[model samples]
Target: MEKPRKTAIFSQVPTLEEPRIDANILIRLLQVAIDRDFEAAEVALLKTLIQDPCLNFQAVADKTGYQMYYLRGQVGPRLWADFTEVFGRSYGAEIGKRNFGDFIHCFLEKLSLMPNSFLQQDLEQHQIAQIFEPGEGEWAIAPSESWFYGRSKELDSLGKLLSQYRLVTLIGDVGVGKTALAARWTERFGAKSFDRVIWKSIAHAPEPDILLNELLQEFEVKELPQKLSEKMSVLMQIIKRQRCLIVLDSAESLIRTTAITALDPYTSPDYGRMIRFFAEEPHQSSLLFISRRRFNDVLRLSRANRAAATMRLEGLQPKEAQRIFEAHGLKNSSDWQRLIQIYAGNPQYLISISEYIQTVFSGSVQEFLRCDTVIVPDIVCQEYITQIQEINAEHRALLFHLAALKDPVHFDQLVVNLATSMKSQSALIKALNDLTEMNLVEKQQNNAILFGLNPIVKKVILSFPFIGGS
Candidate 1:
């Protein structure tokens, strides 16, 4: 008996001998808001097609030294389907007819018309102004909108976390409204929930000493603690005595991605000691951390382990997205529903796109949908793209593999697929766990416990250039 061969799904395509468009240009085009690491197999195939658009699957298969059966049956269909979904066209048919270069030209031309491109062009010609001033007071941090739609149910759960847990973390992807929700929660119940409320933003990555001193100043401690240990003791005493509620925005700064060991405290030893003491020791006060990524130290102490608590935010419900659309004074159409789905109900993304449509397409959701392009504004795109690109290469590659699966996969399947790329089992598990922590991958609720990439994440991964020449 012989074992079955398993070639990579994207490796069937050959590298381009002479590309029509600059490979770098194509690469830049694919790097959207949800950018991920390039896939080698796909990149090779794409490069080949860019050089010789008329080459069919058989030619690609021959060039790559892969069986035509494997290339055509497994790789070609998935590739075509992904292109169709992203480009909103019969991309596969165009490729077959050797009109791929023409399609690329037209797509790039339309991309230039998008609002994001306008910003990009300006950025290329000018320097951006820095506007991230240190935030002060709960009022300064709170959502400016007088009315917040949706999140009623989330508020209830949040209330529970605040009441029961010593430490609570609000985690979500960029622009998922974590800060708005945190600020609103604090503003609504600040006085009643605790004796004192304090808000601070770590957006500028302040040092642990600076953060501690600022809080101490707020506490009006006449005698400052000279040592880190003494500072933690003093902080704990204040928290217990005053029943304070501390809100730390962008808490991901405390995370040390360069840590030598997983068990080690977060990058800032002082901050790590502070959170540990807050979670472990008895105290009347609570701390709320809002961040795009969850820190290992925080999770270790979360209520799941009978220590702290965490709330992971998802996109808004359809009705909530509708509120955004209505706010923008846009009329509803069938395309409205699809638009919401395409952006995964991200509030910031919805607002940005709605404004883009209003300003550029005369508030016509139908016209925008007919164009069939993912049009995330430069501001929101930069936010998400930075977060995605920050992940280490190995973990990122794991995510790319998950995205390529296109279906729910079991742990064993992932292990086998990952091993084919020569990743160690332990490393593979670590990468998978990292993805889980970021909420990029979800485990099915069923007992079987299959895993799959979130739909929006998958779309972003597919949008990246599949070619490597760039």
Candidate 2:
């Protein structure tokens, strides 16, 4: 007999009480996966995914026994709507509200991540807290007093540039401490030269009105201006009266949509006008921008000159990372160097993995180094996979191969080997370039580039059942 026709009215509605995995359950399931308790996380993921109790989102949580947080990264309006309809709020709400969007208009203003956030509920909590609550510690500064190690020259260079221009742009990869260095200097010493220090983070692009309101509220302004122009004029007047230092944290603030409508007042020009008029053009005032990329590449800040002083925050020098270890009372230079190489100078990685090493090895860096395993945790690798996916597929393939190999293999031999499976030599080189740009691979002094997949990245790749067996 034919199956009975399905009727909408006959369908059983799912509820939070139904033991069906809702967004809340799905997200928590994802967290357990990246927490890398594979034995535990897998059991939970399988139960949540294998028999989904019928949800719209497919079993993307499977494909690999990794976090569902890596959503093949559609990150478009459709996904946002789909998740919101099912989950009752944007993914940001599950993570934290204040950092992400609230409703219409001011949507997706920021696209940054908490370093290795998928695995850490604490970081997620901190960002989500910002959604509804206005926060004071919005700006990050490397405390000069406690700024134990790394990048002294970069700091001095930043100081010199600020001495010349009223505004300076600090750009680098995530976890490079751009905000820390900026705030540390200003809070420690810049206050004497620059009368006042004000820090603001544009994590989610706020409306000019909202931002202005916050500034007024923070400064305890008695009167407010109605129009933006009038407001900037008044704000500029106030800023001018006091020698001020302003840190516009997060590079996202510099952007306006490429498709903004004519009626929209939040044009690139309006934003630029406000910054230049209120902050940059004000008398004896200095402004600093901390961002992931050179803000100009992504967003056109109103009048921020192409010639404005720029600093590309580089990785922690080997010696600097060593000091970080030594400060923690870890001896053994060779073992420490190996650990730094595993983290590759990103402060978050260095700090985290080093802490782990200390906890396990108790300053005996050699004990931590004894295991040939790359020191990175499974979660960090999983966290970076979306970024890894953005790399050229051919290069990603090479990366997977290197990951499987585990021990560093000779460059030419490996290239020749991977090339046989790829389309051509050109394809191999292009793939290498992609991996290089993503910092998954590095070239040795002899020009032999190797896939230095941060230990965690290597481990995750190797754990994939079919990595190089294909």
| lDDT against the true structure, each candidate | 0.63, 0.51
Q: Which residue pairs collide, candidate 1?
A: 10-41, 16-47, 16-48, 18-51, 42-466, 43-466, 43-467, 302-308, 303-308
Highest-scoring model, lDDT: 1
After superposition, which runs of candidate 1 have C-alpha atoms over 4 Å from their true positions? 1-147, 258-261, 303-307, 401-417, 420-422, 442-470
TM-score of each: 0.63, 0.50
lDDT of 2: 0.51
Q: Encode model 1's per-residue lDDT on 1-470: one tens digit a residue.
A: 32212111121222233334565445433433113333555555666665555444555656777655575576555554444345432221223222344444434433333344333442210111111111232222232222245988877788789888888899987667787677657656766788777777787778777778788887878888777777777888888887888888888766654344366636666677777778989988888899877766777776346578778988899998888777566665656888878877788778777767866676789888878677656665455455567666666667778877858998888888877653688877776676777667777867797988766666566665241011
Worst 10 residues of 1 by lDDT: 125-134
For candidate 2, the C-alpha RMSD (Å) to the true structure equals 17.0
Once all C-alphas are superposed, what RMSD does model 1 give against the true structure? 20.7
lDDT accuracy of residue 338 in candidate 1: 89
What does candidate 2's lDDT look like per residue over 62-168, in tens digits?
44455444332332233334334432232223221111112211111111222233223333323332332223433222222223355668778888877666566
